[model samples]
Target chain A: METGPIKQKLEQQWQDLSLQLRAIPINPLERKWATIALLIAALFIGIIMIDALVHGINAPSNVETIDSARLHLSEEFAEDNLGVQTDGSGLITVRMVAGRYSFFPKHIDVPAETPVTFRWVSLDVLHGVHIPMTNMSTMIVPGYVAQVTTTFPKPGDYPVLCNEYCGLGHNHMWSNISVIAKEDWAAPVKSAIAGGPENE
Target chain B: MNDAAVRKLALGHLWVAFGAFILACFMGEYQVLERSGLIDALESSSVYFASVSTHGVLMAFVLTTFFIMGFGYYIATTSLKQPLWNQPLAWGGFWVAVAGVVLAAIPLLTGNASVLYTFYPPIQAHVVFYIGATLLIVGSWVWCLIMIVMFSRWKQANPGQPVPLAMFATTANALLWLWTSAGVALEVLFQLIPLALGWIDSIDPGLARTLFAWTLHPIVYFWLIPAYTAFYVFVPKQAGGFLFSDEVARAAFIILVVFGLPIGFHHLYMDPEQAAGWKLLHGFGTFVVSLPTFVTGFTVIASLEIAGRLRGGKGLFGWIGSLPWTNSMVLAVILSLLMLIFGGFGGLVNASYAMNAMVHNTAWVPGHFHLIFAGTTVIMYFAVAYYLWPILLKKPLFSREMALVQLWTWFIGMTILTTPWHILGLLGQPRRISSVVYNNLLTLSWDPYELAMIVGGLVLLGSACLFIYNLAKTQLSPVQDGFVQEIEYAEPLHAVTSLPEYLNDFKLWNKVIAVLMFISFGVPILQFFFIDTFGSSAWGY
Candidate 1:
């Protein structure tokens, strides 16, 4: 081929390639359906998530009554004498005075597989009781007792936090919760916060 | 100064904006990773908190405030077909504002102020922090005054002619901001500063929160009105279509400014500062503001439909495809609207008086805000920068393909970052946490989403770098492609050559605002003097 004809042939080939790449047609109905499906899926996913996270998917345990569960939580964490695990496991009691707080048996020597309940009441601003391990949570207000019940599935150290955005030091006000093995709670265990008279 | 000088002025503003944006991008990536808690090296609470605060202030405060003031001056001059009335004062405002940002950055970068952007206190920062922030807002107030004056002067000089749509919207924003910033200005000057400096014995937190609430809701409109102005005035012309309705556009601006006020209590819904009745009144007002959004939506979409129809598309929604997808402005609107739907829905849930309990103070708030502010509003800012910079600089874009890529990545990255954030929020994960120290089921459930966010952040960071690179090249390119394009505004469909004094005016709007503020806030605010209420003890000092 002559030089001019060769240049024309290359130009024609590039045009064919451009047309092929740019000509991919999109279907309208398919696109609409895809958007609709994605939206519906997002909605369903949101519902399932909230159902699992907030309202929760699993039903509240097969325990007989809410009243009974409240009682267990209330007695275990009261500031007065509380129901201890008879297996020599210590009990914890918490009280709020004005805006200050004091705890009885702040560090509990609780046995493994034993369920501990927190009975909390706020004297001032609203407070939330949250234990992240077992997802146990409740809210406490002035004169209104709120309780949370959870079993220590493992012997480890965990923090119990006040999740509410209360005044200040909200982050620093958390306390420690230690889970002891069944054998340790049966005997005497060293406590982080000793049950001393001066602490009161 | 000549037109060349004005062009240089506009270019400088855009250059600073892109510079701040790229720094913000890297900070964003670092944040997502630090918050994720997967990598030990990237985990530093001090750095994370400081970075988050600085990133938010830069993007939300510095970037938007400076960009808006600069663009407003230019738009006011060009759209009204006049020179800036007070150039020296405008430049003075610029310097003062820039100085404030530098002062604020000293404490922020050094970790003296880690108030995590929102600065809702009891959480005290250095006194210089509060002072710096005050100066920034004060500088903007000067710009706002200048704008309102220019609008008034323009109307005086050229009466009976329809003042351009762009100038009208800019003036509306200036007036809206004047009313809007006063709330926070009073709060900061009176309460926050005194509290931070130990001058006040006890701050009335209820009043402070209420004042902040007054400024809270409408600030979004301050960011949004500019974006909407571009949508109505610039995008239509760029898409090769006429504006659907000039009157409807003006009505939307009026409604946004008027109803945008008196709806501040939605932020106070959870606070005891405002009573239930007042909050409800504000709640109802919040719902009313959504009406103008719908009005804008219909008008803009209807305008797009006309463009599509004229371009030979048939059917109701078929016109969506007929839109000029290759055009950056049109593409940006499509993406912006997509984000608005998701973010707006999140806002609906947030605004739902009853449902607010579900996600209150959760990660959802940040997620919703980031999507709306960053994805929806800032992306449109990008579109504006792209459109304006070329004309203002008298140079062709260095890379159109790169701009499109950057915009797409930004949208995708925002979705990735925020979707997980909202889910985590709903799952009971709190916001403003430096890290998750516990290895528990609930915290563990957040791991996957946090990882996604980190990845998304990286993508966004890369995209940000690309954006700055493109703009930099366009400005400093060796190839001098001389392209001089004057600003072309969208013409109203009905061709409103002449307008009534009331229709093409803010004089009536100003009077209406005076009466509205008196009726809505007069008694409620005055009640503080008469009522016997306890105040909060000085907790900050």
Candidate 2:
């Protein structure tokens, strides 16, 4: 079979391969291309970092946990407590729950030109909600809360749709968000014990 | 050069892989049609989701696992010039996987396991589905074990010698799979299976997703390394030139294994389970991983250029035209790389931390993956099959022209299908929906794209059938009296006299993988236990 010659040839190939490996760092063309690739990768990371740190555009990663099975019984996510609320500081927040085929508080109203924090939890399975044409999208995983705070600059009616596959009624799972002018919206009365107006 | 047992074993796996692939193609076409709402009668979400679940499992898991196993077997035998390490154990693994597929199909077809392929809990499938899927993974573990054993045995027998590039890549993939599959294995064994079996009353979807995030990203590389192996070892030779650099190819495989595992949180960017810091960290790694693809593109293109120049083609772009277009391997790489360019761009967008919000869970996600996985990866799979079938069967090809046409149509069809899909994502269409029943002006705008996708699906289905037909004909044709061919790996530009151990082995890389995975995933997974969390009851069929 003349195995000696074949083995010698293979041994030569191995040495040449090692030489090429050594040359990679010193070879002008190879070094240049490697540097360019690294720089491009760094540039991408830089853009992402600037977007997160400077531009305030980051992933919706509010790591808040909740008892999803008892979400409806919770104070913030109670059925009657769902939808738009205004705090003492005049900050608007929308609390909602996503179930098999629908978002609780099926319709919502918020003031335009103001930031609204959406706090969503899933009652069962997993769901994702997105308000079309807006940066208001987050996954509603059971056992945790998904929160996204964004300002709707333009006042209009936007469809709040379930983007994640939930169940048989996934496509049917949607609601509406009406972003009204700030002046047109009325804040609900606070109880007198809470030191606020009692208008019905 | 393969023995009868090895040939039978390889063919068995390939047939199953392609069988699953062709079936999944039909389901893909049905999905686009149903989702489009163009056909009124096909409007059942139950049926649609069921089909989608089966489609994803078949194409992503069954087709890939079986095909990789088959291809690994052939590459191990032919390249290493050794008999398969354990013949009966290999067949045992194959049957275990087949049994799993059959078990899972029961639930998938009857709509009991319509949880989609991700099967994220508390959306539960039948207990049998979890068990079946676990069996499939367990079967692949056998293949992994066999590959590692053969690799070590060869190294021991021929000390200080460089392993064949093909076998080296196969062993790398096998090791990567062992690491890659562990995440899902843990998730299934502890979370999904127990929950489905009613042993656990509540399950944390957060922890499930975190574990899946471990497997999710690297598994793509597990699927892709073989295609890259072909690009490195087979394509250059097929194109009639030497490999640009064998050392560079080894480096690429090593980097892919190391960088690929710890960066899965890019899939979890929009999820609440992981913190922003971890997501950003993984996002950085995601971009870093693209370096190998860039190097691959350069090296492969340079090889093709050399081949073209050798064939007397002149000018900068003339090499592209002078490539052996009739050769299925050459034609497939050309098309595969073209798809990789576009798909890679889409992947970068998905990996972008803030930018992902625009396309997260949208049709764009599917579009990006289909282009990369189905278009780029599977196209290479076609080339490898076309290249291997005649050698395995000792017969001539049924139709070279038909194979070329199939490759072109696959590229064209994939482009047509995915372009509008990406557009639909930008237009704010959520993926995995059975029907678009919104009926608004915005929804109506998606109609033309949907129509285009239907045409694309039809073209892809026909192309798939042609691929199978050519291979089947090749196999069934009577063996030639004097058919003689040997698998040829591309030689490097210069012969080597010696090499370092790091480039020739995976022991160090495996350690590096462990450290990287721990650093990236340790706190994220551990936090589930430390934090106050709730688990949800089972919710779906």
Candidate 3:
């Protein structure tokens, strides 16, 4: 493993390089450029934050604490309120409890062209509800009620998947959003009441 | 200085670091293969997670800690022209950290500590694992103390002089790590240990995550400063030119240590405990931190440009072509910067307040970090090892050609591995999944990417092996003629005879960090104790 000639070549190259470098010199970084870069970066990120605000990105900022242990017994998250509920103003609120490996009320039914608020709480660990192809996703952290409001402009089946890892069956944790016509949403409700919840 | 004593100590650390690195590389390949659902025989969730946890710790904690400590020792001694502040204590820290790693490896390997490296509990691991990890941090704290002490002692001896750039940067990392580790130290000592020992019934995940976030982001800078140190201090000399600007390099280090600490809450943007206001503030801080990275890139590239032009290159970008690509250090910097460009873009996307929704918690997160850590940072570590091994061992590199091949393969393999991983995230593939075996259309879409990742992982595994082999051969080979090399610190184009106190010393910056950390984290963390928050019981062992 001898390279006498190669070693000499490298040494010669080094000397030549030093000589060439000494001939022409340039300063790479200027303090003004650094300041400018920082200012521009701050401004760029600021614009994004403003855009986020405008687009209702942080709509879930309204902080509300919840007793995660007794979520099932709580009035807002009771079994009766586990599905869709429509108010007088025709706005629908979908409440669900997100736990390990499942989002309860696996099927969410809503009406198109109507404002809907998806509110949920994690029973254990951190779970995130990310609906593919839409701007609706919020984290379900235990001891806090997570809320995000949006409207389904068009009727479609949107799969709601838990993007965050929550133990073993995380991959299996997914639900379906059944956004139907406004007229269709009314019929299922009326029929359920008339038939007595169990029969329906 | 007793050069032999220092070299022996440094070599011991490097060996351990590389030993951990090689083992983790094997595990990394296994993880990618297992998660890709490419092989049914390798599909055990418990085993896969155990492997991932060990892999993450060995690479992230053990490898980086040992390597940085070793490099810092050699740099502090040679650059300052002084003996190590304390030799026996350095060896003591080494053994204690080794003991911690051994203790932790038991649980990690046996699947008792299958909780991923993040260890965001509710999902608890064995009590021994937490204790072992705590000891590791405590051991590294010893190194941090030595670095600061050495820096101070050198300054006391030589007043108003610019601490050598290498030592200055090393000391900054020491300060950064001391502050960084405190967050997780508090969490582990008070919350995790008690819960794991069954002394407490439950632990608050929010508080735990808040604390980990403090360590999580800056720990990256801790791993990175060494790589940056190499860029500022080694690359220019290796490229056959002087450093572009010493002052710019100093400022970059100052800003990195200052801004790196408080911006960690961005990791908690999707978590529940912290308010959006705090997350937004942290997000802004995250953006501010990018400035130093840009400064580093500009300074290093300009240094290279000068090197190339001096080597008889022409034009604005012709310097790129003229660079000494055959040199391992020069080649690695080019590849590292290339990776940083993409990785840094991914970082900005992650830092974006709203756009984060698109990529948060998905495969994108892993992809982005892999590109940054393993690609940009680890590749430079390889370069540094190649550059330093001969000097440390008093032997010529066994094979320079092999080193070049390894760097190229690492760059190519990282590209193949992470590109598909990022795409899978965009396709809604979640991270930390053991397998994506569902044969649905969406899951099937990930198949090609998964296959690409397997090929990439295998290539990376081969490259990693080559790197270790080359270093081992270099160290074991008999001493050669012309092999006696001394440490060479890059000189700046413009001489720096003196520097301001703030640049030369970290005392003022330390106070600034304290104030910033308190302002950013004080309320968010204290509120956990102040409020009547419920704790979740242990769900996993």
Candidate 1 segments whose C-alpha is farther than 4 A from its true place: A1-200, B479-481, B500-502, B518-541
- Measured against the true structure, the TM-scores of the candidates, in listed sequence, are 0.77, 0.95, 0.93
State interface RMSD in Å for all models.
12.4, 1.7, 4.3
Model 2 lDDT per residue over B196-234, tens place:
888988878999999999999999999999999999999
Report the C-alpha lDDT of model 1 over B1-541, residue by residue, as the tens digit.
5566666656656566666677777888887777777789987767887797889888877878877887887898789878877777777777777778888889989887777555655456687887888888888888898898888888888877778999989988998988988988888898878887888755554566567777888889998988899899988888889987786687679888998987886775554334455655666666667767766776677778888988888987888888898788888888998898899889878875545645656678889998999888888888888888778777888998998998999889888888999998877676666677644455678889899888778777877788788888887876556567788899877776765555577777788777876666666577655665444443331
Q: Give the runs in model 2 whose Cα sits over 4 Å from its true position.
A: A1-27, A182-200
Indicate which candidate wins on DockQ. Answer: 2
> What DockQ would you assign to candidate 1?
0.03
Listed in order, the DockQ scores are 0.03, 0.49, 0.20
Better model by TM-score: candidate 1 vs candidate 2: 2
Per-candidate total of colliding backbone pairs: 0, 11, 0
Task: Name the 10 consecutive residues with the lowest summed lDDT in model 2 chain B.
Answer: B493-502
Whole-model alpha-carbon lDDT for candidate 1: 0.69
What TM-score results for chain B in every one of the models?
0.96, 0.99, 0.99
* Residue pairs in candidate 1 whose N, alpha carbon or C atoms collide under 3 angstroms: none
